[model samples]
Target: MSSVDVTTVGRGPGLVVLPGATRRARHYGAMATALSEMYTVHVVERRGRGRSPAQDSSYCLDAEISDALEVLTETGSKQIFGHSYGGLIALHVALRTDLDRVIAYEPGVSIGNTMPRSWMPRYEQLLAEGKDARAMVHFLHTCEFMPGGALVTAMVWAMQRFAAEGRATRELLPTVVRELHEIYALDSDGSRYGAITAPVLLLGGGRSPAYIKQMLPLLVDVIPNAKLVVTPEFDHNAPDLGHPAAVADLIRA
Candidate 1:
């Protein structure tokens, strides 16, 4: 297997953070910094992003879990925090291994076809047409959070600026598409998660879509040691977005 890139920040007990579909560990700078104050933060740059090698044909959810396991073993971090698709990966890891604690923020587990089956094809078409920005916009719109008009408009503007500035959000499109496919392909039942023995803190956002919010209860009911917490003031990207401090406080608590 290819080597995974792990970046360390702060000082204290080991804490590994797995970012969402964005797969950009650097984007979690604020949250890592905050958590670093209380724990040594090890951020894993998922394959196809940052310093991690690009994904090959063999890439799959198992590969992601393996990458995470390697990081956990290398860092000896028993505590993990995962957001979005990363959360699903973390949960899977906990199910198969013994982890002290897990804190997941809106894992992209589908329950009752939470994701529209038509989205993948539409997103692929946009990518084929070289409309990466539009593809991202559409992807966000379809997300469980269903970002509103203002947020969507702002994201479009930001994406446009990034493209103009040569930062090109388009570069990350393939990884985004692949991860979305992975999420959609997953079966929604929490029955398998019942085997996880680690204590879990399932978090969601009040402003997030009903589907996203609904996962917390199902997860809590299935995972014997799980609890749910909703941060009413934030949405899906709480840690990397506006409420890193709030999220950090929760982690610390």
Candidate 2:
């Protein structure tokens, strides 16, 4: 496994930020800049992206959490912010470590039974057949569940941009494909996260689609000391741009 490269800025308490799947720490540049005003922001560069090393292909979620722990231990920071898959990693970290507080933005696909068990396998097949964009479509569809309107058009536009930019073929591809099975294989008993005692801030976009919309309540039920923040006018990318200030408020809160 590769070690995460942490960039420190500002003063006060320490706050480590973990990005979602397929995105890099720089993707959180705006939030990092905002958070840097009050806290020492350590933007974690997860394996296979940024300055981190390439993933071993046999890696699992536990390994990813270990990496975050290593960053926390080295940085001596107890506060963490995880977005999407990173949120899931943060949730698992909270269960294992003694963090002061954690902010998780939409963790699980199975949290609301929105993803089918066979999805990952089909994605794997598509990848093997060199249908990388098709595979991406499947994953995106699962998250967005596009409706027949502007949302659908937006989804299409995003997918086109993603493909044109070779987003799926980036440094995170191999690891994303290999570890997806690990995510799919996780048992949906919900009891696994019941042990987490850290205060969690659950942030979800009101316009993020039905599947992600469904994740909010499910997460509230699973986490003991958690508060939900629903950004009504935003979607997944809301954290990136549409509502950076709002997201910063949540991080700083």
Candidate 3:
């Protein structure tokens, strides 16, 4: 918690954002730009990304959540928005900390009985072997689901294309692969949400994976003071595609 560097925008109460493991704070530039105009936005760079500290070994969700809390304390912002794995961290923060409010955008921690039981260990092995492309492809085909099969296929294709150039993809790939263990370690049985007293906005994309849809209602049941926001026009990655103004307005409300 000592001297964690933060990239701030605007000037007001803190509104810290935690990006997905594969994305850096810079990737949320569009959202930060808009949110900054209204409230001071602190985009957490996450450990090991950019100038942040280097992650020398394995990672855990608790550690990631602690990093987010560090940002919150550093910026003094109780309002937080977490996307994907970031959302999972936000949820943990709400459960474990005194964050004024939180917005979790489509966290994929729930696999239920639908997921292939073998995928986790296999992914771990691939990651250990340094076969990231193969690992990512495996994750997409099995665990990278986002509701509709067609859309998942398209998104996976795009990600694969981007990942084809190893150098271009190296920056985030290690984090993504290394953090898989942490993400899977999350317990989404709804027990953790009972501790959250803040007004939580659970945002989901209609076109997201069926598992995501299945998990949404569960979140409502667990988070004491929470509401649902389903956006049919956007998918899991929509927040990065200019949805922050709308999101900021929701937070402001």
- Cα RMSDs of all predictions? 2.6, 3.6, 3.9
- Kindly provide the TM-score of model 2 when superposed on the true structure, using C-alpha atoms: 0.84
lDDT of 2 by residue, 1-253 (tens): 2277776787888888888777777778888888878889888877777567667756788878888999888888999988877888888899899999998776654653554555677767877886655666676665454333446545544665567445543435556665556667674756677788999888888777776677577777777888888878777876665676678887786
Question: Considering TM-score, where higher is better, how would the candidates rank from best to worst?
Answer: 1, 2, 3
Model 2 scores worst on lDDT over the 10 consecutive residues at 145-154
The numbered model that scores best in lDDT is 1
For all candidates in order, the CA lDDT equals 0.81, 0.73, 0.71
Model 3, span 1-253: residue lDDT tens: 5334567888777898888756777777778887776789888887777677766775567677778777787767889998888887888787778877888888645644422346667766876886655665666557545233555545654665675433434456667655766655654477777788898998887766677777888878877898988878666677775476665565666
Clash pairs for candidate 2: none
Off by over 4 Å in 1: 144-158, 161-168
* lDDT of candidate 1 over 1-253, digit per residue (tens): 3377877999888998888876478768889998887899998888887678787776788888988888888888899999988899999999878998999988878766765556678878988987666677777677544553657756775766665432434567788777777877786676888899999998888887777877678778999999889989878888888698888888888
The candidate 3 region of ten consecutive residues with least summed lDDT is: 108-117
Model 1 TM-score relative to the real fold: 0.91
Instruction: Give the per-residue Cα lDDT of candidate 3 at 26.
Output: 71
Error of 3 at 132 (Å): 3.4
Models sorted by lDDT, best on top = 1, 2, 3
